[model samples]
Target chain A: MALKGWKELPIGGVIDEPGKSREFKTGNWRVLRPVVNLDKCTHCMLCWLYCPDMAIEITVNEKGKPQMLGFNYDYCKGCGLCADVCPVHVIDMKPETEFLKD
Target chain B: MLTNIDLKKAQAVTGAEAVANAMRQIEPHVVAAYPITPQTPIVEYFAKFVADGVVRTEMIPVESEHSAMSAVVGAASAGARAMTATSANGLALMHEIVYIAASLRLPIVMPVVNRALSGPINIHCDHSDAMAERDSGWIQLYAESNQEAYDLTILAVKLAENENVRLPVMVNLDGFIISHGVEPVEFLPDEKVKEFIGELKPVYPLLDTEHPVTYGPLDLYDYYFEHKRQQIEAMRYARKVFPKVAEEFYAISGRKYDFVEPYRMEDAEYVMVALGSTNSTIKYVVDWMREEGHKVGLLKIWMFRPFPKEQVQQYLNGRKAVVVLDRSTSFGAEAPLYEAVKSALYEASARPQMGSYVYGLGGRDILPEHIRQAFEDAIEGNLLADEQRYLGLRE
Candidate 1:
């Protein structure tokens, strides 16, 4: 969203939109990004619990089994917390510029 | 919609008690009080009111003044009518969140008993506490008597809750002098007060689960300045909304209130300017000086924040000279009220010769004679514009 002028902003700095936090794509300024392999042997969900930004995505399949998904880059600040917390060593830190060309 | 208006009978009550009575009538949704000297009896009485089932309010006995303010901030953010009362040190402790309360535009009403900020450890009447928060973005109203202490507190709810003026308000009374001394204060009908204040229509309330919103979110450089500017505009808009609220109050109470109450300024060449309870002393002196044929009047300022600069200039414009009495000083700078009056009259085509006096620090006695001397100096042109003369201070 475009930044508003002083008069255009709402009174009292109230951000009325509940889920606008996703609009802040913090991955741009990060030096490196965390890449994860969802095809790992085990889905321990350890990285999901430790990711401070809630960037580690997890989904449930139709069989009621937890499946690990890739890192959500929208809010990930490239903190490498998810890479550090992954037990299977499937997640790695790579340069954010490497994925920029894609 | 205020009708069948009848002024209630007057009863003598201490200033603190009067404030409590006003708060009870308003019946705020929440009150977080941590009592200090001169501001204790106010919340104590309100707490009793709550205990006795007189008014159903969630009165929190907070551990500290900081948490007291924090509690009310949370309550008011959740779209409740919230209030608190505090004194010198208490206000200092609440200072950080006090700014947050105003910046967040919560229409919280607070009663501030003016007391000396102590290093020498004094519990007495002075404007130091309120003066320190001059730029904190709260609308400040100084009460001269118990009647004003009662009336303005009630009026402040309407003033604060006005859609255009959704900022916190501080209704101030002198410590001990008004807070403890008994005075004949007229009370409004409880239902009339509730009717006048209407309801709290909070904007973007945090408690609205159907439409969730953020309060006090970090804006950083991207939007912090804009939010601050928005709060400044809210303060500015208060001046425009003040009179409309005052008019509505007049309809219900039959009392007219203005930003500055001028006591007999017509055709007067010399004027005395002051705030808080000292106006009563200056008024008595003004009467005495008029009987002896000195054309002197008193301009008792009621609203200090969003300072009534234009109204002050209009009143002091044609005067030959004027003396401004400040109950608190800025240590090195000209006193707050005096400095404000000087700047307000700076652009006047016929500016009055200004005499600044700092008096009654630490609740020192300000007799009528001190006010008479100030007026005499103004009339005789014996005042030095550069000097801040002390009144009743033992050098």
Candidate 2:
């Protein structure tokens, strides 16, 4: 049994499904994830705006390369808001249905 | 299923009593209210419910409408299903906190017994009080009759509490006309109402000791607008959630309401826009006018805050002209509601020529004939010259 208020992994790290909980994986699941092409991308953060769970983060480099951040699947329910709002077609919602592969 | 519901034999009650009965059914955790005309009976019945143990809710007798709203906001933030009722000047008094409740995303339900705001005070019904705060971040539902008033009160709670629509809602019932007028209102069982509402647990409520977060944060000019923008987003979410909530309510309660109710508008050459109780009278006139081969219609706006701009745009796309009836005046300027309808029409791809007429100030009785005249006038001479047309004032 887990210690009371203790024995946890990193926040937004891998989370164990609670005992007897049903797995609810559906939709276009992306495993490797969509990487942004910064030269063609505008940081409109429409992906960030539409994210229901606030999982997507946008970071900039010294050269001002705006990159679409990766997913924290522990926190992400796999809702493809990030893909839907990718105005410049930079971030693609590649299927991660393999995560549920036995 | 609900073969148990006896719609006919339900006791005849006023709008206030219907609201009172609905409140009793929900059994709120706390009720903070101040007495005002027409709105008094709802709080009175709630107080009696507390006394009789019909509802295990705490009845807080606040000194003013400000404190009434303040108390409910505090209670609601603390994870209690808080509620209150006020009218006219009282709702106006609770003004500042109304925006606060919605910003904090507190699912507080307030029944605004529609009354005229005072200057030379007259005790009467008008949409002036509710319409004054039309831009406030709260879902607004205007009821045409006592039954809708009662049923909408219950529906307001469900809509306001939904996760997608975690915002406050005010159910506006025109004072005296509906608040005092008796009509047979079906009373749903408390268990049935409870089942429909499910549980009252708010997401990350203020009272939770395990995980805590600050609410109603003080934002500077930089953040304040963004916070309000988020509120606008929430209101948009609410617009979508409202119909779903009402559909669920209808499944259980056998009552229904559309945000914007249209009457005989399919082939309307001319139409009238109205809110609150005036719609009831306008509907009657529309039906009568249609019988005489006139293509007149009425669009009654129930949900005002998340103004159904697109919905109204779609409905009024091909109309020749629309006469918006404003219950409250904007003094030297155009009526506030008339301005909203005009603005909404402006956004439409092809909007009909819309005109506004200010009517029914300080509880003046608006007759069906006045509605008929407005329809006829809009159709004829295009009497769109005056931005303000008084409804029932002696010339």
Count the clashes in each prediction: 0, 5
Scanning candidate 2 chain A in windows of ten residues, the lowest lDDT window is A5-14
Candidate 1 docking: what grade?
medium
In lDDT terms, which candidate is top? 1
Please state the interface RMSD for every predicted structure, separated by commas. 0.9, 14.2
Q: TM-score of chain A for candidate 2?
A: 0.47
Q: What is the TM-score of chain A in candidate 1?
A: 0.80
Clashing pairs in 2: A29-A95, A29-A96, A30-A94, A30-A95, A30-A96
> Each candidate's lDDT (Cα)?
0.89, 0.78
Best by DockQ: 1
Separate DockQ for every predicted complex: 0.70, 0.01
Summarize candidate 1's per-residue lDDT along B221-304 as a digit string, tens digits.
888888888887887888898988899988988887889999889988999999999998888898898999989998989999
Question: At residue B42, what lDDT does model 2 achieve?
Answer: 87
lDDT of 1 by residue, A1-102 (tens): 688898877888888898887787776667888877667737778888888888777899999888777877777888888788777888889987687689
Off by over 4 Å in 2: A1-102, B1-7
